[model samples]
Target: MKSTKLYFSALLCTLFLFTGCKDYVRGNGNSNDRPDIILTYPELVSMLQHYDKTRKQQFAAAVGKDEDTRINHFNLKDLKDYIAYIEKECKKKNIPLTGINFISGAYPDNYRLDPKKSNYQALIMMPATTIDGEENVSFDPFKSEKGKPLSLKEILEGYSYTSWTYDELKSRKSKKKSSRSTQKGGGNDLSPAGNRTGISPPN
Candidate 1:
């Protein structure tokens, strides 16, 4: 009975070891490792070039222009067309177009674009305002103040010195000097012509 019991115990130990080893292997297996094709930089550049040309053409045609305009004035339809073009190019190159992300406008009041860059591994395109007022877009101010419009002096006071032109800076400096002189009774003296006023002069 002792020998039979020892033999059964050994068999049990073997079964346990086998099950443990099987579980360990299963847990560490790489069955889901699949090959994915990625586009090279050259391929991506070519794709972008083609997409840009197509976009320009489509935009011109839709806007009723014979040729492409330097300034991009895109409406909702133009944006959709551009997105579709990018999607098609991405598919051809086996890249995920939806993964690209974009942002527009100032902080706290902007729209996000799709397929945002990850770890700085994406191409980005941003729309810019042109020299001409063709593509100018405005955002309403967050808060409106009810008062008279600020005068030129008030505007200048709030403006940065670096942003001022040479003439503007000189003008502001001259005005400041004139104000100081006036305060010191140098510009206009209110003293009586014949009598020495007892009022002390401003320091």
Candidate 2:
């Protein structure tokens, strides 16, 4: 009887541990000032890259590249550093930020691509504080009374992006040497209907 009771209790605890947090950044939970929700760095990057490419004139002056510059920005190492910097900033501001675990945004069981660094660029619903100081947590992008929300645009205005230039990528030939197009995947996949899963059109 004792062993059986312990087994069920252990199972219940495990389930709670995994499901309760939902992969928010894990540090300094004991705070009223922390952002109820946070947008991870990669999420911001994906948003800006889309705007930079499609919006054309709007971001051209801000990003300073009028041409179609496929801003691959940083490598894996650089991304980790950037995330750390955000974490540091949150700490300084006495605000807690949450992050999520990335999963393969791909489909079709046998498709080829690295899933860890793939699509799933959707803003998640957590909690957040309004500019008026009320914790009206919602899915709407974080904003203040002052201006547009802080995101990659703010980051790019000062950020020094590393190079994965489109021209550079184009110069290299894929090892496959097959019918597959010689295009470097932007770490995303497509749906059966041929939708760009990563930068899907916003609804």
Candidate 3:
């Protein structure tokens, strides 16, 4: 009877170990498993290509582009910090934040006078609050027409960007894949690269 009890206990322990390993493996394959690093350069290039094909002309009309023209890239840290700051301020004023409002803005031609600035187009952001789940109001403390226009020259001072032409992106796709595989732990190598979303420019 003592030997039988020992055998049953061992069997139960083995079963529990197998169950735990199965759960661990299953968790890794689920949607909750997120990547550590940013999306690879090849991924960004593919997205840019799709955007260029579908919306380049319209974007150019709305906000002109040139070899010197630049797009704004927000730092992950800065964006998060700004959101937190806004939340804190809202809380103090007893305001509830529902979302953010992004307003399109274009710099004047004289904005080039500021050598430090790279952005020709800007997305001005403001924290928004909603009423009765219908009406939304953006909390804009800086809203004023009497004062001199704010200089956003400092806005583009810190960020870095790669200015590769469309042709360059296409050429470097395969090279980037092999090099990135060795550097990026071979993540998403099995997956297809480039715009696989079936969006194409008009022939």
Candidate 4:
């Protein structure tokens, strides 16, 4: 009877240890699990392309002139107001609106003044700006009667501007993988001497 009791106790202890080990292994099994909010560069590029298409359509609908020459003088005031609205929304959500780039290029010299000229014929202004400033920037394409700068909100949304938030979350899993790869590759092994003198040290 004593021998049987000792055997049963040893079995129970082994079973508990095995079960704990299995649980520990299962808990950390999958290394591919990453945050859902983080987006890849390709995903961001696709989104920006879609936004550009939508904006172009909206601009065409707003302006009766389809020719690039006529649209070349597009409402800079409205664009500024739109940016302001984006900033306000980002602040409300506590998201830093960095990495937002806007570029507008000037039209070329050959751009024709003819009404029949294609809208693409206008010189692209290629103006670039970002939303990571202390205060929102403003521009006025239209001159007021008093030559004063027009309020962007009034020009863009008529009265109140619409807002949108863009948050890009960082992925810890991806960052960790990148760090591991970098470490395995030997961080900063290729010094200036290594590049200039094609001789590498043998380990």
Candidate 1 local lDDT, 115-153, one digit each (tens): 121111112232112111222111111111221111222
Estimate, for each residue in 26-137, the C-alpha lDDT of model 4 and write its tens digit: 2357646664668999998998798667765565555443322222333556555555665554454444444233323223344464323323323222111122232322
TM-score of 4: 0.19
**Which portions of model 1 show Cα errors greater than 4 Å?**
1-74, 104-203
* Clash pairs, model 3 backbone: none
TM-scores for every candidate against the unseen true structure: 0.17, 0.21, 0.39, 0.19
Backbone clash tally for model 2? 6
Task: Write candidate 3's Cα lDDT for 1-203 as tens digits.
Answer: 99999999999999998887664233367855655656889998999899878776776576444322235456666676777876765565565666666545544555554523333555556666543233344443222112221111111111122331212233335443221111222333221101111111110
Off by over 4 Å in 2: 1-67, 98-130, 133-203
- Give the best candidate by lDDT: 3
Q: Candidate 1: which pairs clash? A: 99-115, 100-114, 100-115, 100-116, 101-114, 101-115, 101-116, 102-113
Residue 5 in candidate 1 has what lDDT? 100
Better of 3 and 4 by lDDT: 3
Q: Point out where model 3 deviates above 4 Å.
A: 1-50, 61-64, 67-71, 116-119, 132-136, 141-203
The candidate that achieves the highest TM-score relative to the unseen native structure? 3
Candidate 2: give the clashing pairs: 24-99, 25-98, 25-99, 34-96, 36-127, 37-127
lDDT of 2 by residue, 106-147 (tens): 233333553432322322212222222322321112221122
